[model samples]
Structure formats: structure tokens, C-alpha cells
Target: MKVVETVSGIRETLANMRTAPGKRLKVGFVPTMGYLHEGHQSLLSKAKAECDIVVLSIFVNPLQFGPNEDFDKYPRDSERDLRLAEQSGCDVVFMPSVQEMYPNPIRTSVSVKGVTERLCGASRPGHFDGVAAVVLKLFHIVQPDKAYFGLKDAQQVAVISQMVSDLNVPVDIVPCPILREADGLAMSSRNVYLSAEERREALVLSKALGMAERLAQEEGLTFEALRNKIEGEIRSTPLADIDYIEVLSYPELEPVDPSMETVSRTSDMIVALAVKFGKTRLIDNVILHRK
Candidate 1:
């Protein structure tokens, strides 16, 4: 596996990939803020199985983080990240510094309007703008045939997909399902900052997701009822600081009104939640298609 820390270096690396002996290789890209876990590995694994070469970029994007967010405290371990990248069948790893990514003051920013206005975007203003900007930059840099993203950040997936479609970026956006731990916490890079007690309490997000599925699908509860049940469960523990417990239409991310639908079942809906355990903020969601 090759590690290129500079833009010129990574571009030079990929220039060779396209001109290789056999037919042009199809590249799959996975962009991550490093702290390699099963969640990230899963994207690389899927990309490896499907594409000729998998390129993984590990850069903690300052753009995607809010002013008050944990950008500095966000985790990093290059030695371990590289080892895991190689294990996950990654061929090239792009590990760039913030200065390298944004050499000059970046005046250009990318934003997806409707999708960015709600959920995570509403709370953390301009968060998706940073995400869209960086992802687009990587897309141009790698120019992969396809890119892989985890559905754990369904809002993010929705935003990027919208950006790709609206901008007519030629790469396919492949969103994989959420990968969780044995007891069901949605794996995140920030999971490292969590205390042992907070780690145990973190399962509430997953449990709430489970409850979300059962209540909405089987019981066909109203949006208010579904929200109440999930909120009640997460609030059962004092440590789970509730940020938002939203039941809304998927991809579009507009809130579903109980008065309009009677029951929460709609076309394709998402049960999304964001909660803080100590200093670590965790988000999880379940996507359901109409039956």
C-alpha cells in the first residue's frame, strides 16, 4: 500500500494507476477522518470487493467541524490507521494535513440547500457546507469511478448524494448500511473519547433505533407517539443528553406530521437521533421503506 501526504504526490500516484498495463483500473474511494474502526473498514472492504483499486483518504476536515466542536480533540493515530487500511484491502491511502488540503484561504464553499437546513445541519450551522466542500475536493482529486459512505450519517449521505446529483459529478455515490458494535452502538471515530460508563450508556442510541423500528413498523404508532416512546427510552438514563429525536421522511429529511399521516409509516422514513454522553455526542438512525 502507498501513503501519499501531499496533493501533488497523490495525484502523481493516481496518474500511474490510470495508465497501468492492463485495462484502465476502476478506482473506489473512501474518505474518512482517521481513527480507523470497523465502520471505516467496512467501507474499504466493500470498495475492495467491488472495485479494481480502493483509495482511502484520512484527513480530519476542519471544514466539517463547527467552531465549538472537537476538531482538535477529534482522534488520530496514523500508524494504526495505515495498518488497518492495508488490512482492509486499501491500495492507496491519502493522508493530507489541513494546510495541504486548504493551502490558501478557501473562498469557495459547497452547500446543498433543503437537506442541509434540518437535522444535523440545523444544529451545527454550515457543517454540511464543509462536508460538501471537502468531499467534492476529494472526488476531484481521486476521480474514482465510485465512492463509499456509511449510512450511519444518513443526513450526510443525503447531503453528499444531493450535491453529487445537483453538481452532476460523474462518480457513483454508494452508501453502505450502518455497522454497529456487538451490543449495538453505531461505531464512530469519537467513540474513543467515551468513558467506560458512557460507552455502556451509549447503547441507548442503538436501543432507541431498535425501538424506533419496532414501534413504527409493527405498532404503526403516530409520529408523536413514536417520538415520545424513543425519547422516553433514551431519557431513562441521566447521561444521555438528548439533542434531537426526529422521525422524518428519508433523504428529503422533512419532519412527518402526525395529523397528516395518522401513523408514522410513509414512503421512505428515517428515525434519527442525536444525543450527548458526557462530552461525546452520538447520532444514530434507522431507514424504513414503505411496506
Candidate 2:
């Protein structure tokens, strides 16, 4: 696999590859912030299975992080990431630097409303704005027919999907299933931030979500009651600090009213969690589908 750094080089390379005689390449793209893991590999593997060529971009987008968030300290291993990408059948690796991507000061950005108003968006102001901007940039750069994302960031997937539909960007957004650790903690690049004890405590996020899903399935609990129960479970873990626990509709992420009582059997709901274990904050969600 070839590693391209400059914007012009990647564009030129892709253009050339497209022009190859008798070769029709259906390109699939996976945009990541590096620190490759099984979650990322799942995306690559899916892309490889469905596309003629797969491209993975690893640039720690400064736009996606808040001023107080861990941008500088975010874990990165380009050499290791490249190895993982190549091993995962990535045809090309676009490892651009911040300077290369921005070139000059960025005066513009992209965003989707309603969907960005709650959960992570409300918790971290302007977070989705950065995500939308960088994602659009990568979408433009890669120009893939299909781009993959993990369903772990359900809100993010929703926002990006809405943006593509609204803006008429000609790329398919494919959300792969969330990959989890054996202990049920949602896999994240930030997972590396947790200490051993904090890591063990982190399981509460998933455990609570699992319980919420089961309750929605069998117990027919009210939205408010389910959310409160999930929050109570997380709080039970002394090491877990709750950031937000929300029960919202799928894709739209519209708030499920507290007074709505029980959910219909056919309703789709996402139970999302954001909790801090020590200095590391992790997010996890479980989508309850009609049985």
C-alpha cells in the first residue's frame, strides 16, 4: 500500500488510478484519527469486501476537539497505524499533517442542526461542527463512492448522514456495527487514557446501556424511568462520573419525552452514555430495535 501525505499527491494518485485502462475501481473510504484498533479494522475490512479499492485517512483533526479537550495528548502512532491499515487491506493511506490539511487558516465549517443539539453536541459545544467540517473535507479529498463509520458514534453518524442528504454529497455513508471489548466497554481511541482501575470501572457505561436495552425490550419502562435507571446504575460505580445519559429516537435523536411512558413495540430508541473515569471520558450507546 502507498502512503500519500500531500493533498495534491493524493488527488493526483486517485485520479490516475481511476484512469487506468480497463480498470473500474469502486473506491471505499474510511476516515479516522489514527490509533488504529479492531473497531477501525472492522471498517477497513468491510470496505475491502465491498469496494475495488479502499483508502484510509489518518489525520488527528484539530477541528473536531474542543479548546479544553485532549487534542495534543490524544494518542497517535502513525507508524503503527500505517502497519494496521496495510494489514487490514487498505489500498492507500492518506496521512496528512494539520498544516497540509488546513494550509491556511480555516474560515469555513459544516454542521447539521437538531441532531447536534443534545448528547455529545450539548456536552461539547461546537464538537459536531468540527466533525462535519473535517468529514466534508475528507469526503471531498477521497471522493469515494462509499465511506464507512462506526455506529458507536450514533449521533455523529446521524449528523453526517443528514449533512450528506442535505448537501447532496455523492458519497454513501456506511455505518458499521460497534465493536466492543470482552468486558463490554465500547472500543475508543480514548480507551488508552484509562488506568487499570478506571478501565474496569468503564464497563459500567456498557452495562447500563445493556440494561436499558433489556428494560425497553421486556419491562416496557417509561423513557424517563429507563434513563433514570441507567443513570442510577452508572452512578453506582463510584469511579464513573456521569456526563450525560439520554434516551432519544434513532437517527433523528429527538428527545423521548419523560411523560411518554412506555415505548411502543415497534419504536426505535438509542440509549447513549458519556461518563468520565478519572480524566478519561468514554461514550457508549445501545440501539433498541423492534423485536
User: lDDT for each of the candidates?
Assistant: 0.90, 0.90
User: What TM-score does each of the candidates earn?
Assistant: 0.97, 0.97
**lDDT score at residue 89, model 2, on the 0-100 scale:** 94
Q: Which stretches of candidate 1 lie over 4 Å from their true place?
A: 264-266
Clashing pairs in 2: none
- Candidate 2 wrong stretches, greater than 4 Å: none
lDDT digits (tens) for residues 151-178 of candidate 1: 9999999999999999999999999999
Residue 203 shift from truth in candidate 1, angstroms:
1.2
lDDT of 2 by residue, 205-271 (tens): 8888888777876555678888888988888999988898888888789986776657554568788
Best by lDDT: 2
